[model samples]
Target: MQNILFRLGFLACFCSSAFSGVTYPPITIDLQNKPPGHQITEFRTLTILIDTRIDVININAGVGFFLIQVHSYMGNITLSDDSDAQISGTNIGLIWKGNSENVAHFYLFRDHLALLDNITMLIAVSTYSKYDPVPGGCNLSFETEIAPYQKISESDDFITVISQPPSQFGNFCNRSNIVTRMYYLYLSEHDNSTEQYFANIQKMISVDDIVKYGTLVLEGLTANRFKQMYSRYAGTGRVFAAVSTRLGRSAAYVPAVSYGCDVAAWDADCSGPGKDIFSFISGLAFALLWLFLWRKFGIPVVAVQLAFLLNGLLVASILFYSQLGDIYIFANDATFWTCFVCLLIVTQKPFGCLTSLFYIIALSLVGSYAVIFAVNYYVGGNLPYILLNTYRRITVANFGSAVIAPPYQTMDICQTGLWVLIFCIGVYVQTRSSMGRPPFPPRRADRARARVDENTPLIEPNQEMPPAYFEAVYS
Candidate 1:
């Protein structure tokens, strides 16, 4: 009994340390006033942003490995200043997580920080036992790696290794509700001078790009304050951050400069007030038609969808032949068409109720597409081009042949706002309009009543039959 009690007490102590065991070197004592960094000791996760002034953040984890991710979504992890030193020590790993813009530095290794504005993510994990670099990318479901494990003795313990390759390459990520831009940098260690690191990074992200996108400065208090924040509010912000981020960014991670629909087209063809006006008009027409006529005239809307789908399929085939956007884009659109066709087929018999659901989905798509096209066309946002270049790939999908989609500072708020607004309204209006309505047309109630009356006798059961009734019966 005493031994068991001792074991329980030791386990409690170990657990406490594991939950709050990150210790920073004494050199960071002066930064006692800034905002605290984000940390979750349960996963041995710690994230702190360093800028021009500060240097030398050496985080030591207790009981297990530390996972440090310098991601774009949580704000950038910038090492702009030349004087900045190494942020982490050995046995710790860094996951240089982000989209295509931020992940380019995956090969740069550690002990070398650079002026990072955009590097597409490459996930690397350096465990105390060994280092694993996942060239495929970061998995958002990676928190499971830190789950409690059963020990099979100190020398040979059991651990779970999970890797979920993202589906965004073919536009599958958005459908599964995954954010491709989020990088979870597992800690790593290597030897590269800061100058060489910056130079290599400059090759991909030049000074001009930095000047163009501007810089992100994340302020945090001393490493001690980070500890305090972790103890006080570690897990609470993650959920809110995720929710707010998804709502803010159209539920997808759009890269800074993606392949535009008219990627090789002339500048004038891609953007103009005239084109914007036309796009706006067409988009508005489609949106209104979906709102008002989809329930009443679903067949016409479906016909339009079929036309677009066929065009998209043809464009995808051509793109495959030309090698324009890559096979993933082709595959993505093909999947969409296949799924839609299957939905239509099944709605005929076994699941006729699916027709109503199908209409709702179709309406929502129309509304969202219309809004996204108009807004992105006007602003030259990357999303519209991504839609055409990646998911739709339809012939004549150009926003404008002469226009180039410029990198925007942030997602056009108006676009996302209007997209969401229009989608919600479409869903609400269509759903309400469909209430108490049958999924398919039925015989008129009055007609049914009339038919019943014609089949019945014209006389009461208990009374003497009328002469007319008898004559009718004889006839």
Candidate 2:
């Protein structure tokens, strides 16, 4: 009994730690303050952004492995100083953990401590575990490494564009949806520091041409308290955009910079999200359609789903041929396409219903594609991950001109087409079965054994019937 009690107590503690284990290090977080009049403590930090190839290197470890797991949903990160943290010792190495909502961030790996403004929140830990790189104490020790970021040629005085006009890349830039994508490509490819923060630009190359250009794209999100920022800065006349590289450079690609004013920047091409994606309201309609004219409408309803398949296909094709945004529109459109697509898919029925139940899986794709899918090693969650969503660009079919552009997103387009075809065919079979089969059939339980002699013909109901016809006359 005592042992069991001890075990239960230990288990409870373990569970608690798992739920709120190591103190997660946040970017630009405010350290705890002392009593009311106490002077605020300050820390020194420098940042240099650099990207090194992910060739496996042996890391020395003294504290079992101090992994730093920093998480953020808003893709915005700010660094006040020079570069990423440097890890001088050969023994100590960095490991990172990405949140279900965000993989684009890292406190685990070495990156520049670039929080233009630090957040004011301090989280302390209750226990000493191997996972904390950041033991918060009076004397905190930090590691450092020195590596140079990918550099652009001095002559390449390029511009950063957040969004172009309708002339955007389909997968990366969409005037209709995305304000901007975090990176031109995946997180790994961002080693080259060619990208700038809050940049939108004309496509010197297609969205998929990151490899060919060998450039890094820094056009990420602004998780900054935009509402507060505008109220304090833009609202109070802090012309950050005009002053900083965030906007207003008329060279290579950066055009007229704009803020996220819903009214001013209304996406004219904003055809609303797909109808099936908005299928929740359709539930009542579908029920009524079923109750009143189930047969008539069922087939018709399926036919109407053509809009879904087509829209999904349009989004998918845009994603598939993402680098070829010139064919689709003016600015890069990938990010907006993903954002809008996810919003619609997650909102609608069937798909929306699945979103609630699917848990981590739901996070794997759909809504947070750019953030969550940035590191997708191609396994793509429960379903294949997509440059274009699987429902549409279903496969990783190779596309693009051989010399200039890389293949759009990766997947089996042929397989996806085959599956969609099979699904439709299966639906057809089921519909036919529903229409042909009877809802219920009769059961034969009420038959009594009646025997007539072979020699005697059956009598009419009106004729008198007797149990013993031969003896009837005498009886």
Best of the candidates, lDDT:
1
Question: Lowest-lDDT window of 10 residues in candidate 2?
Answer: 230-239
In the order shown, the candidates' Cα RMSDs to the true structure are: 23.3, 24.0
TM-score of each: 0.27, 0.23
Q: Where is the poorest 10-residue window by lDDT in model 1?
A: 235-244
Superposed model 2: Cα runs more than 4 Å off: 1-183, 187-279, 283-291, 294-325, 328-421, 424-475
Model 1 residue 368 lDDT?
Answer: 73
lDDT of 2 by residue, 282-332 (tens): 756776765564343334334334334443444444443334332322122
Each model's lDDT: 0.30, 0.25
Candidate 1, superposed: residue stretches over 4 Å from native: 1-352, 390-409, 412-414, 438-475
